[model samples]
Each structure stands twice: as C-alpha cells, then as structure tokens.
Target: MSDAPREIEALIEMMAKLPGLGPRSARRAVLHLIKKRGLLMNPLAEAMQAVAQTARECLNCGNISTGDVCPICTSEKRANGELCVVEDVADLWAMERSNVFKGRYHVLGGTLSALDAVGPDELRIPKLIDRVTSEGITEVILALNATIDGQTTAHYIADQLDGRVNVTSLAQGVPIGGELDYLDDGTITAALRARKSL
Candidate 1:
C-alpha cells in the first residue's frame, strides 16, 4: 500500500502524465503544492479550471483562443497578405515570441504522416487552401519542422497552392529534425529574414 493518501496519489499519477514530469518529479510537485496550498495550489487550480472552461480552438486558423477566431485572425494589423504555416500551436507561439513575422498564422495542428495514417484531410490543408484565396494571401511561409513528415507536408502544401501564391519555406538555419518550438528567438528571426522560395 502507498503511504500517500488516495487523493494525493491520484494527483501525482495525473501530474506524471504531463510532458516532462515523471513519477518522482510529480511526487515532489504534489508535495510542494500541498505545502503551498494557500498561495500557489489554489490559484493554479482556479486558473486551470478557468482556462479549461473558456479555452477553445480558433475556427479560422486552428490557433487556441477563447473566441471563435483568434486575436491574430481578427486583428486588422495582421492582415498583411502573408501567411505563415506551422505544424503546431507551439510553433506559432515560438514565432510570436520572436516578434519577427507580423503576418497571420495557420496552425496545421499536426503534419501529414503516412505511417501514422494522417492525411491532408486529417490536418488543416483544405482550410489553408481556402484561406489563401479568401484572404488574398500573396505569400505563404512554411515554418514546418525539418523532420521527414514536416518536409512532406510542406511539399504537399506547396503543390496545393502552386500558381496561386508565392510559397516559401524557412531558410537553412533550422537544424535537421529540430522543431521550431525548441529554437531560440534569434535563429527564428534569422530564418524568417532569409526564407527562400520553395
């Protein structure tokens, strides 16, 4: 039998399931939360509850937002006729942190994968095509990862938008098999500035 109470054990188990936390880390975290219940735990719980209740995906760009459309999608200043496509929201957030790309973004949610049985329909490829024409997009910058699946998805999107808009991919600074979310702000800025046609 575990020494910890059932509720605490359960909380630890759930926390362990998070991206970087394992059993040991989760146990430490749970103990810390219990000690700081009044100051940190309560506020964290309330924040999580509020976000769970209100957070939603943006209908137009697949970005996470509280409303139907994300702030970037609705902002007049972001409608610069340029669209930066990323495989995930983390990449979008990374780009935002870099403050390099002023144009709007299109989050694909995930890349196309034949091994995983993920197709264009499974992603937001069709919606991206629709957005290019509907939004008068003059350029589409693919900031996808350098993985095989990411490259494959970029090529597919390029073909889909061929002859319609100027399609480009991020420059060579991005390491092979590296994800945009892991890149530093300066590298992202440099890559965006040096982007070339696909």
Candidate 2:
C-alpha cells in the first residue's frame, strides 16, 4: 500500500474483506489480476457484472437463481415429496455439491439466535412452512450445522411441522460447532444418508 497506486491499494483492501482472503493474499491477487487485465481481469469483471445483474433469490425455495424460482425448485423431477432444510444458502450449495440429494431445498437464511434476537420471522421459516403444505412435501430433512444455534433452529422448525410431515435431521457425524460450508462433499453425503428422525 505504501508504494502501490491508490486504485490498486483500494482493490487490495476490498479483496481483503472477502471471506477467506487476507491482506497478503489480496495484494498478490490484485497484482495477478492487474497483470492479466486483458485476459483475466476484464473477463472476470464482465462476468461479475453479469452475475450481479442476473443473480436473484429464488422466491419459492430461497436459493439464488437467475429467475423467480431456482432450477431445482422449478424442476418437476425435484418435487419428490422431499425437502432439505438448510441454515444458509452456502449450506444448500454444499449439499448440492454432494450430488446425492435429489430433492429441493428451503434456505432459512440463518439459524435461530436468541442472543442476536433472530427468530422465525427474521428468516424464511414461515415461507418454508407454506412450501411444505403447498408443495406436498412429505419428508423434511434438516441439513443444518451442528452448532447450538443450528440445533435450536432445527428443533424449532421440527416443532412447527410436527405430525404434519416427517421431520428428520442429519446424523450426528457433523463436527461440533462446524458449518456445513466448511465440510467436504463426502461427509455431507454420508450425513444425508444417515439422517435420523427428529
């Protein structure tokens, strides 16, 4: 930052704010992107612009999509009487990467948090309830993390849908206090396969 131009230094600062990036990596990445501006940086910028314009949250399932409904929520093949409830969109993405679950998802946006004053209304919990009934969802598989807040959210949702539909949760293999986005695909698949009733 001491020697770099203001624009480049600003870019590094912004990149450093991204989730997995730090000051050291952000500087290196900015340098790389600047060096390959014609081939990489320009195209990357265009792609980011395109996605920013097109990306949207699916109205039905809460997944990010280019349209009102995500491909999974709109696909007839995915309406298999099953719904996977995830704590975050990132968790939903991780489950998709597993390539094992064929059903659709309901992203709660985040877990229930009393400390932060987050509740069902704060997230998409009400929307999830509506989807279960309207979409004929028979089984809801909870893929939330193993964190305290995650479990609390899971139990809250389970109680909301009690006896109306079969509610289950990912088996106890998920690491304590771990986030789904941090897990490998195989662990996710195994958890899905070993899910137990709530």
Give the candidate number with the greatest TM-score: 1
TM-score, cand. 2 vs. native:
0.85
Runs with alpha carbons beyond 4 Å of true place in candidate 2 = 174-198
- Predicted candidate 2 versus true structure: per-residue lDDT over 123-183, tens digit per residue: 9999999999999999999999977899899999999999999999977657778799999
Q: Global lDDT of each model? A: 0.95, 0.92
For all predicted structures, in order, the TM-scores are: 0.88, 0.85
lDDT of 2 at 130: 93
What does the lDDT read for residue 124 in candidate 2?
A: 96
Clashing pairs in 2: none
- For model 1, residues 53-112, the per-residue Cα lDDT tens digits are 999999999999999999999999999999999999999999999999999999999999
Cα lDDT of candidate 1 equals: 0.95
